[model samples]
Target chain A: MIEVVFFLVFFLFIFPFAISYVLASGKERLNIDLNYTRNPRYFSVSFREKLFKAIIKDSLLKGDSRIEVQMSKKELVKYGKFNDLTFNLYPNHIYVITNRAFRIKKGTAVKKEIYALYDLVIEDDCFIRAVACDGVCKIGNDVIIVRWIDAIKSLYIGSGCSLGIACSTEGILKLGKNNIFTRLYGHPIITYGFNEKEYKEFSTIIEKTIRENPVQLEGFEDKPVYVKGDIFSDDDIRLKNVIVEGTVFSFKNIYLENVIVGSPERRVSVIGERITFGRGVKIYGYIQANTKCGKVS
Target chain B: MAMGGIMILVLKGYIISVSLLCILYALRHLIFAYDRFMGKQKIFYGDIIDDQLPTVSVLVPMHNEEKVASNILSLLSKTDYPKNKYEVIPINDHSEDKTKEIIDEFAKRYDFIKPLHRYGGKRGKPAGLNDALKIAQGEIVLIFDADYLPPKGIVRELAVNFKDPLVGAVMGRVIPVNADKNLLTKLLDLERCGGYQVNQQSRYNLNLIPQYGGTVGGFRRDIVLETGGFNENVLAEDTELTYRMYVSGYKVVYANRAECWEEAPENWNVRARQVKRWSRGHNQVMFKYFFKVLKSPHLTFFQKFDGLLLLMVYLIPFLLLLGLFDFLILFFLGDINFIAPVYVMLIPLLFSGFGNFAPFYEIAVGAVIDGLEKRVRLLPFLIFNFVFYSIYISLGFWQAILDSIKGKKEIHWDKTERFRDKGAAD
Candidate 1:
């Protein structure tokens, strides 16, 4: 019985001590080392290569192609034959468009083709006259177009879109399908410092515009052209040499000239050489425009 | 008839062995309780101060202590001690983070705040302390860790004890700041109260040498330097030094009034690391100094006897293991009668439960009430103080035993986590 008791005590107490002694000695002699290599450019290139392949696979499986208008490549290709087919290519490729505007009228059978050049992807689609492009533009499905677009990189236009006159866009212009632009005006010429009678006539016209559509004018040094309608533009709208009698809501900048803003009671006119509007505008109220301040008889 | 007699003898032997263990543990509880509580002997404030105040260099050794470094610096900045009489030296031991930056910023702000940075990896805590000790300009050097926030009059209180020519070192009471942080901290707080308030005081009352804890302790700078500062090789240099001081016939005094608050580990893993390190270090001290303690002609017979008994206390776990072995043997031998006196073990169990854990519970509850009255967040940690911490201490005993055999003398300073609570500095 005593022997059994001693053995149990030895197992519980002494054995642990013996084991720890051995492990501790072993731990003391162990060493660790690490290596560092400096090659950031190579690392980034390899990382990008992997990322590019993943993006392509993801785009193909789940990409929506509803709004993209197919363009005829028969005139573009050397063989001059039209084909409606999708093509696959390597990851490193760039796509560029030579011309800004190419018209795709109604009942036109357009050819769809893809071009790849050194890490850039370009899609050939039906174009419009006087289009704008800027930056790296990504076109989504169901893009609507109501005006001409000016861009830096790519312009993705939606299908079945009508163009308004004197409309322009800069940078990348992406449009949703079936968008409409009702009225667009070219530069207007108006003389400054008009009499009160001329200001009253201009004020009536501006008030009439504000009563119509929702419009917002911003970044005007003088009182802005109160637009009751929406204006969509691809870039900044410079309002120089322009008079807005109605609500002008533009996606681009609005440049103003020596113009008069008219209200129902009176007309306010200012002589300004240049004023600009950013992004777009939406107005829910009244607007008026005049060339010179004058009394309305 | 002879076999029956032999069976009776075996049964009797088992009962006797079990009863003896029960009696010993019961006695240990009584002594531990009496020493911790009733045995506390303190010198009145008026009786200690008799001479000119000595210049005190408070050496604060820090490593990766950026979080609480500001609080410690601010606390030291508010000390009531004479501005010129004391200097605060914060030794940064090769911290990889913003610890040095914070220390430098504080040093620029306060004239009394001096910062020292070490570039090489830690040689050990003792090595860091020794490095700080080399440049300490005060007559008395006080050691405080990064977590310790000494009370306003602490330096004055600790310094007063130095008037006694025979006193080589003075150890102050270290109270846990976040006593109610969790069960682990509460248990640690209780153990400290039992140890410092009860055991240490009792030893002081009995005129025996109480062990010096590493922090919140002060020593005569010259005496410490003469004794070779602190031995970097030993695990528990404080315990080793305490033994050496006693053998050299120097009196080590316990200053219970000089209080400092320090944070205790809130979890079992940290508590285990701390306790294992402490126990292993104490064991190493015991091994290194046991012979010298016996051979020293300066120590009286009673002091030598007390030292030896303290040495034997480390072996108590082994004795408990033996008792368990006897219980197992009696069960397997098909002798039901032999295990009859197993109830005897319950006596010590009950005593420790009531004497140690119950008092610990009372103190924890009181600390919580105080914290609540003071509107402190530490009140919440009082709930699980016993369940988590008691298990950790048991684990520590096993780890200590293992560490002792391995001759693992490397100094691993397991730094305590600090909270951002501004009220804790108060």
Candidate 2:
């Protein structure tokens, strides 16, 4: 009985503990790299730029001034592969590197990713998988983007478009009416039918009223009316003619009329479940809406 | 006979209370694990692209940190945060080594690199930071220990959270740079993964208090100043700052994607000192802010509950230590009842006992989430860490109690020993 008990203890407790200690004593360690690089938003643009540079530098290339070098299957097979970037792309994946403007024809179905280095314009009723442009990008009406669309410069989308996962731009994003999008990132996003003339008189009147008779909100700092701290409210927040130096957050809805949030030197954010912008609302930073974001007529 | 009966009752009560505390902690860990594994993740502001980023001052507190000062400074100099908008302030607090020379060299090279040399006054990190805060010119202040190596995008990732207005501070994830050094570093890496990836993220997701870790995190300068800067007396100024932010109606956000690397203690002695110091500092903050959190009108019910529980975490181990003695007394007296229903509660209690600060299953879950499944084999080894922590943490608890009894005001800050050579950083 003693021998049997010793064997049981040896197998169950002693063995596992001994193995762990030995492993700890040894020079073995888990593979955890500290320097991990993440892909930037303009990853495709940078990748294409690098590839173009490599191709131009290659002594094997027969052409000197070939801006639009269409690689044959054999050339594609022998292309210089660098890092994770492979030339094993599908036939549908188009690489357009040009100094001049390019246009995707009307009703074109872009089944794979497109990396364009020049100004890009897509015609009406097009279906795109993903597209990244180094310059300005203009999309026509009824276009459907299945994955993502990114542009380095001003991006304009016509009415009745369907933007899939995300539509981001380094510059301004002008989104037309009746567009469907999951996420958008831009500096000063403008929607369709945003007419300055429509609410000019109403905005002037509201601004005058706010300046004359200012009402106090609970979460905001009192006096002088210039908000130094961020404005946060659990309920709907309505601001008129207030210059805010910080971010504004409302859990419910936000209505802004002639309110200037942040400055060129200091950028802030305004976020809410739903947001309605009145005339003369100038935001110098990020803006996000969970449900719906629009401008009042 | 009456005395015997009273003693038995007391023993039973103590056991029951300890068991319940164990259960509560286990439940908390389980909830955090589940929330991280399956629940909808709360998105951080790292994805937001803004050209007009806030002016930031990156503060690096140093004391005889000549070994790793230049590495962090080099990394900070190359950060993606606009050089014109941000500045690096390396606080050299009474370092009687080559630290000053190294910092001065960098200061001369980079215009944005400003070195703050504190030759006198209090010598702790909090005291050093107070001096830096006075000269800081940015709207946002990011703190980094001299040993840490922050990534290029960490500044941008942490700074964007300030746009929330409600967020007073933002904490990033910390990975051990020398995790593969030894068993101790490996274990520390696992603990860190569980702590940040699951515990902190879950707190952020549930709208509870996400702690603002001193390093690899940034906070609004005005908010800290308005709340009377870092308390020079408090050792765990980070935990104190966390509670202060919460009570003052400001929030601290956690960014899981914003990862930085730091060297973990390679030896047991250094690890013990680090734990004891953390425990002492954390317990001090607990005593300081326990009532303040309860009375705060800004916190929700869940926030208050979580905050209180977090404050009492260090004290629980000491209580559990006492409960062990209580259990022995009851067992010797033959007054203990080994009933069937008790076994059901004891299972979870057993799991909680094995992994004290971080439960075994919670660490396993964290490893799985972090794609480090191979490290799960090391879960059994944490039993040793649990015992080690229980002893040292209990000692720290006793130290805190003694300090409270004597109304001790003086602070002694012991910096963790850096194992990284100056050449190793390259």
Candidate 3:
């Protein structure tokens, strides 16, 4: 009886583990892709840019008078989507590259990555996929971009436009009121009613005054407060009229006005939950906000 | 009578001490499992896209790595990072194989591929890195073992963290390339999952010290150079660097998404040697930095606590081994009345459950989180691995103690054997 009891106990203890061991799956090999790389081209703009460049290169080599290459529906269909009614590509489509200035009609449900050498304009309520323009890009009100836009020159976005994941310009990015965007990059990202000419004039004047007097800004009686090291805070950070040479990290919200983070020679980072930048804030580095980031008064 | 009483008291004290250590470690694993399952994950800076990226120097230290050298080199040369912005430096550290020839061939082909041939030097990973660091032109230095295959975006993902001045170093997730090769590799793959997916990520979420494993990670050039390059004597320069950064008021961030594939040891002999080396080097670091961690003003209370626990991880196995002997001695002597002596048997089960140096629950949670359902069935097999680990760890621990007694300053480096065929390279 004792021997039987011992055997039963041992069996009970070892049965589940043994069964699991036998029936267990051994497909634990991880797939490693050698050529796997995230596309550096935001929204596949490089694809359109390369296509444009290739066409131009071929035209120049052939000495063609007219530098234009048009693909028919058959050719375009190979790339992707097609609109049967309009006989033009739309909705989840591929590339549309052209050298001349182009305009999209109002309320057009356009869905293709476009690259234009000259000016590109979109009328009100037109939905886009992605666009890259060498010249100025004028986006209409209520425009919705599904991906991104890159304008080598000025980019003016109209009011109530949902400006996709990213919108960048080498020149100024002028945004209208209630324009929603996750990321915006430009020389100066300005809001509605802020004229570019006036903004440039105001900025030049401020630069001249700063160069000449180096005067202390308002609410800062202590002149020329320069921080040589990083500023880390576990709480909310509010800085005004200060120059930080290194990164600024705040566990909570950050409010900055008239603050310069890093010089052109050295770039730093600003990390916070919600960052609000007032006027005259110049940053030479990266800015990351967990929740929301905006420009206030 | 008095002598026996003293012996019993000492034995009981040892038992209690071991029990407390097990509980502390078990609780730590429980906390890690719970946090991993429920806590809000802290996001890394991989998604932040910017055009103005910093220059980087990728260092691949090779010691007879001819079998896998070309594989890493070819993959690195084709990365998405601007070719001009990053340079791949493959350090040929006293290779007796065709590693030098292979690296030189790459150098001749690509301008960015600079080969550092170290024929006459103290031949080790640290020594090779020290040589490379002297001539590396980039602001950031990314290191990779010859066996590791980094994705194209890994450089950008790692380099982006340096934008934050407080970030001294960044670590990436390591997955085993040969996970399906054998049972040993499969177990290693699971451990990797638990360590990175659960252990390292939870530490980062809680703002604790996340270890920078030497490969698949990068650090600011100046920060490490300022403190003198990696110590050549330390076998585990990665652990040493991790602690050095933390103790010196710099932070190490873990990029869980920057996953890189590495070839784990395919056989038990290789695994034993690898684990033994880790135990030896890690315990050496423990002895070296245990007091420094306690006194570091940069570390918060919890950071110090976790740092100490991390430092003593290698020594835990040794203690558990001693605890087993203690329990057996008590049982044989007919003195099993001290605080429910049968509980001592659960020490191994409690401490090394379902994971490698992690409790079973943590590994299970990690597998669940990683969506690796079938792999969880192999949890019971880990008991055999625990016994294997305990013996080697105890040996390494004793070796460290002996090294301290002899005041040993330097130890010879033994590289892990590679299983990849020469034809595997592109």
Candidate 4:
């Protein structure tokens, strides 16, 4: 009886496998690689033929008119001119929270802290792209950048610039000699980005930190979460219904009383190391520190 | 009792087959969720830095869009793409209201906003796009539904993806502008987050096939025309384009930066009809592309595998329907014991119900990544989304199959009933 049951289970399992094997064309027999970020497009044909099929035919050969590559910043601006349009990160003006000028770059590096693009105006409906160090950001002919990052009142880039690369988006950027590139047709891209090596270091640091100092949050529920005396949390602090009145810091995320700043009729003030309000919570003063919110006055 | 036992034994084989398929589907989503978590923060804003921006034709297919036409036209006019390089073609697909009048006014106001009125022709977005392509002079054809409001620089952002010699088509993320309107839109906000933020973004990050969603995306006019414009008969011309582009050895780039706002259906019935139409269109594309995807040498093994899974996405509900039949048969025969948890889970019902929660992980991850936990707390309500999808998608699948077998001409493209005219909820 046990043998018959085993046979039934085995047959049932194999039935699906058999069908899948046949239907899948079996060409994808490679072991499943968990590393998703490392994929290179593989063409079935030769490079020459594939290039002709992809670039020449798709682009319609208008790109053949290429001038000699020059490294001067003048050449950069001369090639790609910026249009007069501008994006606003802040409602009325752009703000800079950084103690130093924020520089954007491409490549990977180990860093203590970094951020995705913040405090910059982007009125455009847009998202950021992942650009490798060797890659070029091609702002097509007649295409132009909106005058500036809307939030960053002082942000300026002469060439079409790549924003902080995808891999590293936190802390102070530290670019190495090998991280620089010159053949691109955009703003000379700058800023130290994170790669696999930096990512490994980050994983180790985060793991070690979490292990050494475990978080405790049982007491901060339901009641007003007025963060005081330099509150630091790696995770989000979810609170509701009451007012919050203290300085709080979180390395990851924080969800607090949603401060809805609709129509910049009145300036509301709140001090946040790095904060984002939920929605609808009223505010009375202007935010004093570097802050990011869903809606603000 | 003997006869009942015989019936259970006979049906067990089919049930086992269906169960394994469910497991496969669940496993596929598991990988997607994990990938999304590892890299949900990544976005793709396409960039182009050249002096000569290619001529682009922005195609807006409208049906009774009088209420929203002017707003969208104004937004398009504001885009920073060189005015001379791009033209706006707003095709008025036989609207009963004053949509034509509004579009004509815009056409008169801006030399670029040329309005095309379709009187007596095949009705549907694909049909309209095909007709407009003949008159469109741009090298690239960018499409936006009448409801979409694209931000400044979106045109150039998408056009930049073509800088990569291989990119034949490009797609961008879609954000629901009226996401905070109602419960339906709120949940749809989560759905869209998972669909675009996690699903599409991760697919692009992994260099896998990121689908070219119809709106906020564009294709090389020459390539699309050379290969025959949008398939008028195919409901999901976007899905068809993704498959056809892949099979034809051209790549589709997903631009994270080209984010555009769109209005999602605000009510359950509208949402249900919208999902039904999608499922039906997707299933037809699947049937057409299944073999072609498998045989395409340009696609890597994993790409082919991913494509196959995509083809089966619409069929999940049908499999659940079959499982329901199995349960009914078992219940009528008084062999209820045949559907023990172990057997039932492996069969078709497993993923459709429990495995449906896979998207929850993505939505939660998306919410966490975006720092929107309030919505994450509302994750349980996704069961409503699942229930609606399972029922309607199954009906759509069966209906599409029946239509195909009967040689139905399939002309009317049902538009999702708009709720934009109605004020948003408080």
**DockQ, in order, for the candidates?**
0.00, 0.17, 0.24, 0.02
Model 1, residue A63: distance off in Å is 89
Question: CA lDDT, every prediction?
Answer: 0.50, 0.74, 0.75, 0.56
True contacts kept of each: 0.00, 0.10, 0.41, 0.00
i-RMS for every candidate: 33.4, 6.8, 6.3, 20.2
How do the residues A1-297 of candidate 2 rate in per-residue lDDT, one tens digit apiece? 445554664468767876766654533333333443333344444545654664566523664322333433212312322222222344444444454577877887756566666788889998888887889999999998887788888799898787775677777777766676655656655555443332222211122112111233322212114565566665678776556666666656777765666665665666666666655555655666652343332
* Model 3: per-residue Cα lDDT over B145-248, one tens digit each: 99988877788888877665678999999999877787787788888888998899999989998999999999988989999999888888999999999999
Q: DockQ for the candidate 2 complex?
A: 0.17
Residue runs of model 3 more than 4 Å from their true location after superposition: A1-15, A18-173, A176-188, A192-251, A256-271, A277-288, A291-297, B43-55, B82-85, B222-228, B337-342, B354-356, B423-426
Give candidate 2 misplaced runs (Cα > 4 Å): A1-11, A14-40, A46-94, A97-107, A170-172, A186-188, A196-297, B47-54, B337-356
lDDT per residue (tens digit) for residues B1-426 in model 2: 999999888877877787777777788888888998898676556645445567999999999998999899988887777888899999999999999999999999999999999999989899999999999999999999989988777888888777666678999999888877877887888888888888899999888989999999989999899878999888899999899889988889998988888889999999999989988889988889999999999999999999998998888878877877776677678766555234333533453443347577767777887777556667667767876887898898888888788889897999999999883663
Candidate 4 at A7: error in angstroms? 35
Q: Give lDDT tens digits, candidate 4, residues B261-363.
A: 8888888888788778888889988888899998998999988988888778888777766776886687676666633545644453356333543366767
Supply the global lDDT for candidate 1: 0.50
lDDT of 1 by residue, A16-43 (tens): 5445334323111001111111111222
Measured against the true chain A, the candidates' chain A TM-scores are 0.20, 0.57, 0.56, 0.22
Docking model 3 quality class: acceptable
Task: Give residue A113's lDDT in candidate 1 (0 to 100).
Answer: 21
